[model samples]
Target: MPTPNPAALDFLQTRRSRPAKTLCAPVPDRATLEMLLTTAARTPDHGKLEPWRFIVLGKGAMPRLAKIAEERGQALDLEAEQIAKGRAQFDQGHLAVAVIEVQRPSPKIPALEQTYSAGAVCLALLNAALAAGWGANWLSGWPSHDRGFMQAALGLEDHERIAGLIHIGTETSAPPERPRPDISTITEWVET
Candidate 1:
């Protein structure tokens, strides 16, 4: 029989992402963040090709990125509300890890699998942060998707893109539980 880990199972069942705006200062220190990243890097890669990299954006970097977001939004002719929504994450972020999806040329593994690996890394990192007692939220906005904004703010290469920006900080308040999807409706059991 497989050994059961009730705590891990329980945590997964109850885990909730803290809102980025509700996250405050006192973000994880370098050592703690490093440990979390180490944990996140253990995500499954089909071809053993680590097709993701992390860029740690400290508090000092937020303002600079915020400015870039504002400029890029204006240049794109985005409405004020949309621009503000895009900039809000950076403006409020205490610390974030930018998960960059670096598409590696692989013969055995397809590009789509590599992209899936990158996405898994993002979720792993977010879960790792939350498990380590930090408030964490995964965010991607118009700025993250806009090529010009990405190039100016993060220097992403042609083969790389932003998978997610995981904001980590102390929780100012616990978010109330929201509605959850009905698993019965979403799940399908198959016997072939």
Candidate 2:
């Protein structure tokens, strides 16, 4: 026999990411955000490497990051529309958490595993925020992938990279449920 948490399972089944652009004000306070971060930190860490960290971006920091994104986009010779898209997330963000993947040297755990762990943290944080009744979305765009932007905007080291940027705020309107993947086609059964 196995113990079950129906509520948790139900929540997982119903979970859907809110669009970042649709997220508005009344973002979680520092205390509340801290609780969510703590929950996110509980994600599984192979070999106990804990190769991830969070950088909370408050509303006041949005403009600076947005500007950096614009500059980085231009420096990379990106199109005007691409530059706008690169900066849009920061321009419209109220609050966001940057989940950074920090690679630690380990003979036991591979770098890919560390990356997977970091991604897991991002999902955990997003889920934590949603479970707490906040509109949340995990995003990553050109800015996140640009080393120049990462250096100028976030001051990340060479070994650190953005796993995700999770935006959290009040929901202005409920999002329509999107189509889900067909699980049967993706699943496999193995027996020996």
Candidate 3:
């Protein structure tokens, strides 16, 4: 007999990520955010190597980051619209946690596994925020991938990369339910 957790399943099915642009004030406080972070940190780590970290951007830091994004875009000769796209999240962001993938050298655990762990952290954080009754969205822009941008914008080292920028705040509008993938087509039942 299957013991069904209706509440958990309902939440999983109904959950929708609010767009970063749609997130506004009433961001989670430090105590609440810390709880969410704690939940996120519970993600699996192969070889027990916690190859990731989080950098929470404070209240006033967002505007500065937005400016830096704009400057970096101009320096990289990106068009104005593209530069604006890079800066938009910061300009309107209420709160953001940057999931930093810290690659630790290991003979047994490959870097890909560590990368997967970092990605798992990102999802954990997103789900935690949503479960905590806050609107959250995971994001990664061109600036996250550009070495100069990551360094100047976030002071990331060579071994560290941005896994995600999770935006958390109150949602201004309810988002429509988007279509999901057909799981039967993707899943394979192997009973040998």
- What clash count goes with each model? 0, 0, 0
In candidate 1, residue 25 scores what lDDT? Answer: 89
Minimum summed lDDT over a 10-residue window in model 2 is located at 171-180
Per-model TM-score, in order, reads 0.98, 0.99, 0.95
| Candidate 2 Cα outliers beyond 4 Å, as residue runs | none
TM-score of 3: 0.95
Q: Per-residue lDDT of 52-142 in model 3, one digit per residue for the tens?
A: 9999986599999999999999999999999999999899998999999999999999999999999999999999999889999999998
Model 1 over residues 70-114: C-alpha lDDT tens digits? 999999999999999999999999999999999999889998998
- Which residue pairs collide, candidate 3? none
Taking every candidate in turn, the Cα RMSD to the unseen true structure, in Å, is 0.7, 0.6, 1.3
What ordering of candidates by lDDT runs from best to worst?
2, 1, 3
Candidate 2 lDDT, tens digit per residue, 121-185?
99999999999999999999999999999899999999999999999999888889988989999
Global lDDT of each candidate = 0.94, 0.97, 0.93
Q: Which 10 consecutive residues of model 1 have the lowest summed lDDT?
A: 43-52
